[model samples]
Structures are given as structure tokens and as C-alpha cells.
Target: MKAKQLYTKPAIVGLTLLSSLVLSACGQSVESDGNSNNLANIKTTTLASSNLKFSEHYLTRDVRDDVFYFVMPDRFDNGDSSNDNGSKTIPESAGGFDKTSNAHYHGGDIKGLTKRLDYLKGLGISAIWLTPILRNQAVQGDSSGYHGYWPLDFTEIDPHLGTNADLKEFIDAAHDKNMKVFFDIITNHTADVIKYQECHGDGKPLFSTSKQLCEYVSLADKAAGKGYTPFIPKGHENLKTPAWLNDPKYYHNQGDSTWQGENSIYGDFMGLDDVDTDNPEVVKGMTEIFNNIISEFKPDGFRIDTVKHVNMEFWQQFTPAIIEHAKTQGIPQFFVFGEVYSGDPQELSKFTTEGDIPSVLDFAFQYRTKDVFAYEKGTDNLNDLFSYDTLYNDHNSSADYLMNFVSNHDVGRLAYTLDQSLPEASEQEKIKRFLLSNSLMYFARGIPVLYYGDEQGFTGDGGDRGAREDMMPSLTPDYNDNNLYGTDKTTADDNFDVSHPIYKKLAEYAEVYHGHEVLRKGTQKVIEHNDEPGIFAFTRTLKDHPSYTVIYNSAKSAKKFIAANAANHKVVYGEVNQQKNEFELAPLSFVIIKTI
Candidate 1:
């Protein structure tokens, strides 16, 4: 299952000849200013060009119809026990590789996920998105970087997760099943390592100095003896594995972020040293790092982390560079999406239109769906959310690429959120609401992402650690009964049950979604049903394909509706009482009908 076994290496002479011919045809030339010849620079005026054609050697994978299943490697499953405390470089205690502590590593690795490919494929997932696997700081502050956000080495995979070969095998296994794999990556900052000198009560507003602190010196005022000097630990100055990032100048050396305006973009996030993305040197350094990863690993796509914190100019240059690099390596349609973390359409659209990123996680969709279905808010809000689609660069394509989900690692679980929103509702009603919300996400426009453990009915109320609970016997032999934050509000089922009502419903609908191209890649038009309160309706249509209409009644009472178009329509999925032109929808239910 090694990568070499999966794809044969192309002859060097042939690749060079093909690249030369392709560049000549495009009226462009590749130049190497020298670090690496393969990492050539292409001069192009626009990234969006119809005239530009790549060499026939370039491979392409279209992800427009993909259904992504997001999993946190350490919290998903553990297929290997020997590597539980795997790192030889860092001590085990400092590495925090204990399963009992929720903040520490719980032994899930790539091998574990690879072993469960059948389970995932059976659930109808077309793609898998995992958090970063690069080496991370053993522990940061009071907890470990078990979530894989605090990167220590960009080039090497963490031993705790397994060797590079293990990762290659995982990807190979997934590809064998016709499933794409996406790696989550970070460029905003590294683990908290470099520090600054503490400024006393000068009323200058200094961050807490409990950890090592390096004096902050403005780049412009570093010579006057009035500026700050970074305090790098002995042997740790060159800590990042890729030698280029070892230089102190690569970091901003600024104080903690106040999260007010410009500082939010440039300052350190949660004490992690923010890279000076504006610096040409830093930009070149990161470009080399990611380019190497894409060329070596050849993942299907990337889920960019903390993209909003980086400068827009950096992305404008960086994104195109990565795409070009991938194309040179014979990968034409390498997909990429950013995490904007905003529920505002206006804010999110800027990254796609102005920043040049292809797509972004649909925070606005997640917000509205949670409000309406989980909180029992007016169903009109769902319609209102879709109305803002006009703000995107290409509304239709944007909807097709946007990553839609109910809950993720950073937020409260959907099950827990529904319970808290309607405390008096019975368990059956809560399950119904959860299923209804998921239906909207899967059937609506855009790619749907299911967070791990959500199908098993896991519930956690607070953010971060609370939401990321272990995935039952699949992840670990037994559930970690205590929540990381000790909220007592969080809860999870100890047993992994594929027969759960929600799991069964999701599997059924997944078959429908997979079989119908119109549902996967079609334009949606909302069908207004203002007279029927708590009922939402929409039609997904594509030329040359039969149109499908979807209806959802969130009301506690059954509702009836009549549509002449649906009179002779066939039931594609879901249950509804139909009689010629009239259809009766059960309480808290949904139905999918196809036009004859």
C-alpha cells in the first residue's frame, strides 16, 4: 500500500520535455532563480484563463459531487497501540500521549482510519478530510496539541500519527476505494516557542509573561536600542524542521492579539508565534513548504486553516503559486477551500472574489440551519440565508463548492445544541430535528461534511474540547467518560451503533444523493410556501436532467400542500402521503419528489 505501489514515477526526461512543450504552447517560459529547479516560476497575467492549457500528462479529479466526512485523527480510531507514545524526540509526558486526558493524544493514527475505510465507504462518503498530521509541540500551555493545530515541523509527519509511509498507505487505501483525501494545513502561525522580553507597568498593555517572553522590537526601530529582542531557547531557535523557517526574521515577534481590527491579522494568536506573512522571505518559505507537501503527498485537496488571520495579498500570491506547482507535478484540478469562520455572506465572499481562494466553509449556512431546525426559529430564516448567494463571485459554482455542516470540532455538537435549545422536547423529537437538519444540508446546494461521531449520536454542548469527544469503541476501547472542560453538559453514547435511527436515515439518503447527479451538481430555486408555517421547500434543477423538489415540515403538526408540477412526480426518497395533486407531510418530516 505504499505510494510507489499506487502510482509509478514518471521518467525525468519525459516530464521535462512535456513541461517545455506545454510552456511553449502557452507562450510562457519557466525560470529557476535557483533553490530547486523543479519548483519553477511561471509568469502569467491571470489565473482564470480559458486559453491556458496544461500538458496531457497532467491528471485531474473533479470534486464537485463529493461528500466529505471530517475526522480528527487522534479522536477517530486507533489501529496501532505500539505508537501510542511514539515520538522519540520529545518525552512522553511532555508529549501528553495519554488517552485518559481529553487534551492529550488518544492514540488514533492514519492506520486506524485506513482500517476503517470500509465503514466510511459504506456510509456513502466520497472524500475524507483530516486535521493536520505534521509534527506538533508535545504540549502547549496546560494541554497537549492533540488537535494537531500547533505545528512544530512542517516537513515531517508526527511519529505519534505514524511515519510518512503510513500516511502514503492511508491515502493509497482511500484512493483504491475511489475516495479522495484532503489534508488540513496551517500557515498562520506555529506552536508557541519564541518569546519576548516582558514590559512592566509602563501602561503599554503587555501580555501575560508566565511563559518565556521575547522583547518585541519593531522592524523599523530595531537599531535604536529602544526596540525588542526575541529570546529564543538554546537549540530551539532553529526548531522548525524545514531549515529555512529557522531564521528569526520569519516571525512577526509581536505581542498577543487584541483581536481589534489590524492587530487581529498580524498579532500572535493564542500565544502562538504568527509568521510574518507579509515578508517576502516568509512568503517564499511557506510556498516552498506547501509545494513540497503537494508534490510529495499528492492529496486530492487542502482545507486551509486560519485563513482569515492571514493577509489577503499573501493568499492572492500563495494560492496561485500552489495551484501552478501542483499542475507542474501533473495534477490539474487540485481543490482548495479556506476557513473564514464568519456567518456573514459579505465577509466570506471577499476571500473568493478578492482573495482568489476557490471556496470557503459555509458558516452562514450552518448558522441559519442551526437556528431554524435546532432552535425552532421561523423557517423563513432558512430562505433568507440562501438569498445572500448573490454575493458570491459565481453564485452557482460557489454553492456547489461551499462546505456545509451542522457541527464541527470547534463548535457545540448538533445533538447537544438541539437538546439545549429545546430542553423539554423528548429524545425522539430531538432525533427528528437532527435528521431534518442533516437532510437540508445533504439535499441543498453545496458539498456536505459530516463531523465524526455525529452519526453515533454523540452530544457535547461547549466549544473545542467539549465538541471533540472520542468515537466510542472505534476510536478507543471505552469512552473517556469525563469531558475535557469538565462541563458536565457534554455526553456521548459508549457504544457505536450503525443501526441508530439517525445513521439509518443518513445511509438511505446518501444512496439517493450518490445516484442523482442533479442533487449533487444542480442550481437550486426556493419554492415559497409562506401559507404553510414551519414548512421549507426547494427544487434542484439541471438542464438535461429531471428536476427534483424537496419539502420539509418542521412543525409539530402534520401539514398538507398541493403542487400541480408534483402531481405526477415520482417519490425519489423520504415518506409522504400523496394523492394525485395533494401531498400530506407528517409532523417533523421531509420528502423528495422527482418531476416526471
Candidate 2:
């Protein structure tokens, strides 16, 4: 595929010293002004520097139609080995970078991703969402922060991942391929640096050496000395950069969370120090940090981490602030979605309706899709989930914004789920279910987020770390040891073969989605067929675009179905037995029909 020329504006001349300083920090430079100390003229010069030319088309595009590919950079590919162990200056108390260990860095960096732009573009991805690249805690417990969640410094890039310039190059390369980049970020907590020394009471909020020994205590009670006090990591308390986070008072300092009510909301997550998001200063600090990132990198979107853990009011303030800030930088339709991690649509929709997050990960749809496709459960469960779309603020566009996925890094993979849910099924049956589920996800009413290794058929199970296997099997020694599906696969290669069944199917689906406007951005209505077991159908319609219908049959027997507008429609994709105005969908098959 030919690369698209990213839009660029002519560089502006004349810059104040203050603007030159700011530009220098961003690796940009301007004509120096004689009055080096003059701060008054800085605003004008900086504004000129901020006038970057992004693809106007990308900036204004509706993200609902995008096909997102989420990749954990460290596990994807190692384009640079020198940055693997990170800098010698940075301390790595834990065993340091080890590709053999799932917990350590595997050397995959931004350069690796930049080198694979063609692979992703050919796979039909419109946007790439990478795990956080911020400087993370080098070591925590038995594991290292290779996953990029345990941020040590929010303002700087992790050396293990790449430098700031490497990130810019990756973004530019993606845009050159007509793809956008959505950065994953955390706001709820930082790396676990502070711990509590003693446990005072069973349930009154006393810190214990045991990380998960904290009890529920109201913020008032904690202030009154009724709760556990956290012991700051003496020398490390101020290790976090950007300076303000160094303040001990900014943390809740509560013991690890039990994931229950007040504790879950206010306590530490897995001993990661929970920030006092409710504090006005912390909120202001977080907002400024993310705002600076936006103004500097100008990402097309953000995948907010741990949104539910923070107070709803924090989002009410933070979400709009980021969006408005992007608008000021000339990106008007900046997409931002949060990870709610709830299987209930009502619970997930609250992020959008109450929290003001534009959209959230559609865990509700993911669960139902798994049940229907993997377990051969009826489509009624999925229909039920879609029924709750009304709970979202914008019901008509709910599917457009919600990020839908079959599996992600935090959960068991689709293949693993299929195998565990149907151990009795043959290998062929398992593959069938996997393809069916992915087809439904791609064709369904939401932006499809393809987890990195799913196309290559990585089948790691048991959730969490298990699901986060490397894309290229060559990086890890025990790549084939934990095959959840019992496929006996050994030595995973970064399979970029276009002919691979799953990859081909995904590419085809992406083509159809991009070729047809209705499928990308349309109103969807489920086609009910109570008598038709193992068969599910839905129709997508948009103004002035061709209406399309998608049908999936999971049963072993071919199922015939009639469309009300069948006479005007033709099969644009997928193979099915079509007879005049009737269509017979083969068992475990999917087809898309478009109104001619």
C-alpha cells in the first residue's frame, strides 16, 4: 500500500526566547530573539509552534468506525536490543530485562512497532493503541514493570520502551500509513513505592506488612487517626518526576484494596500507591501532566486506565479538560475511552452517562459474545445486552464509541476461552468458534479492538499475565509450554503471513468495513429469530449509504434465513448458499449482504 502524505504547515518565522526554550525542550527550534529573558512575548511564539498540521481528515474523523489494534510494545517485537536493560543510571533492583521471564522487558520498543507499520496497515487497523510507555517502576515484587502500568514518571518515556523521539517517529510513521495512535495512560495510581509498617485494627484501616491487609475506613476516620498510616519509601518517595507527585500528602497511603466499596475506591490497587484523585491539587496535577502530553505529542486518542477506581467527579473534570485541550491544539474530535472492566452494560454505561467519559471498553458485549460463540449459548444473552443501550447517554451512537473486543491483555484470550468453555470440542470446532466470535466482533455495532496476538493465534489462558504472551514466539524460550487449546504449537514466530486464515479473514473484514460506510458508522437493529437456533442476524443502516445485513450461524447444520429486503441486496462478502431471495448460512459461517 502507498503511504499517505501527512499534512504539514509551513514553519513560522520569528520566535521569542521563551518560545525557543519551550521548542527546544520538544526537540524543535526557532529563530532566537535578542531579548532572551523576555517572558512576555513567549505566549505568541509558543502558539505559533503549536500550530502543527495533522491530517485534517484524521483530526475530524469519527472514531466509532475505527478498527483498533492494541499492542504491548515490550511483547510485540524487539527492534532495538540496546535499550532492553534500560539505562545504567536507572536502578533495576529486580533481575533486570529478561525475555525468558514474562515479568521482565522483552526488548520490544517503539522502533519495532514503527518498522511494522505495513504489517498493521495491511491487517486493516486504522489506529494502534499501545500499552503505556511512561517511565515505570523498574522492579516490583517478583516482576518488573514491563507492562507499562506502574508509572514511575508520567512526564518521561520509559527507556526500556524508547526515547521521546522514538515515540514521535512511531506516531509519524503510523500517520504516514493513515493510522492513528491511542496512548494508554494511568491516573489512579503510580508504582508501589510507599508501604505501611504496622496493622492497628482488623477493620479500622491499619497498615500491615501484608499488602492486602487494609480495612475500610472513611476519609474522615483516617484523618482522625482511626485508620492505618502509610510509611513513605524514605528515599524513593520523591523518585517520581514532575515534582508535585513527590509530595507524600498527595497519596491516600491506604493499604492494598480489597476491591470492595470504600476500600476499592480509596485504597491502593495491588499495593500500587493510589493517588488522592479527590484532592484538588492531585486532580490539577494529573490534568496538567496529561495536558502537557497532549500538547507535546498530539495523540489522536487516549485509552484511560483504571477509570472506575477514581471518583466520578474526577472524570467530570478531567475528561472535558483533555478534550478541550486537544481542541485548542487543533484536534477537535479527540477520542478518549476508559476501561470500566465491568461485564454489565449498565455499569459500563455509567462511565459515559455519569462520568462523562466519551465511551468505555464494551466488556458487556465481550462477555455475551463469548457465551454465544464459544459456549454455543443462544444469542438471547447478546440481544439482552444490546437492549440496555438505552442506559447510555447517546443511545443512537453508543455502538460507534464503545470499544468492543473478544479478548484483551487483562483477560483470557478468545482461543483460550473457547478451549476452556468447550474442552470436549475438536480442534476444528475450536477454530470455528474463534473465527465466528471474531467475525461477530468485527461486524458488530462498535469499534473493534483487535488484541495484538489474536491474529497470530496465541492461545495463552488463565487471564492476566497468561493472556499477555509475546507476539513473536521466538523471543521467549517457553512459548509453546502453555497452550490452552492443546494445539501443541511450539516456537511462535511473528507471523505476518497475509495468507494465514485468521489474518486473511481479518483483512477481508477490515476491507469490507472500510469500503462500506454503513457498516462503519450506522444504526444497528438486531434481527430476531426465536425459532432459528444457533443463528444470529443484525442489520446496519446509515443515511445515504447502502444498508447491510450480517448473519452468523454457529450450529453444525446449515441454517436458512430470509431478509425482508433480500431482493435488493447481494452478498458483498462471505460465502453462503444463496438461492434467489433466500440465503442458507453454512454451519459456523458468517456472511455480509449489502443492499444494491
Candidate 2 colliding pairs: 198-207, 205-228, 473-492
Any runs in candidate 2 off by more than 4 Å, and if so which? 1-56, 92-95, 199-220, 395-397, 475-478, 482-489, 531-533
Flag regions of model 1 displaced more than 4 Å.
1-61, 90-94, 199-227, 395-397, 472-496, 529-533, 564-567
Candidate topping lDDT:
2
* Candidate 2 Cα lDDT to native: 0.72
What's model 1's lDDT at 444?
Answer: 92
Report the C-alpha lDDT of model 2 over 48-111, residue by residue, as the tens digit. Answer: 2112222235667678657899999988877888788876577832235887776677788899
Error of 1 at 329 (Å): 2.5
- What's the C-alpha lDDT at position 242 in model 2? 85
Q: Candidate 1's residue-wise lDDT over 248-351, tens digit each?
A: 67877666666556667767776787898999988888889999999889887889998899999999889889978988887677788999989998898888
Q: Which pairs of residues collide in candidate 1? A: 195-213, 195-214, 196-213, 196-214, 196-215, 197-214, 197-215, 217-228
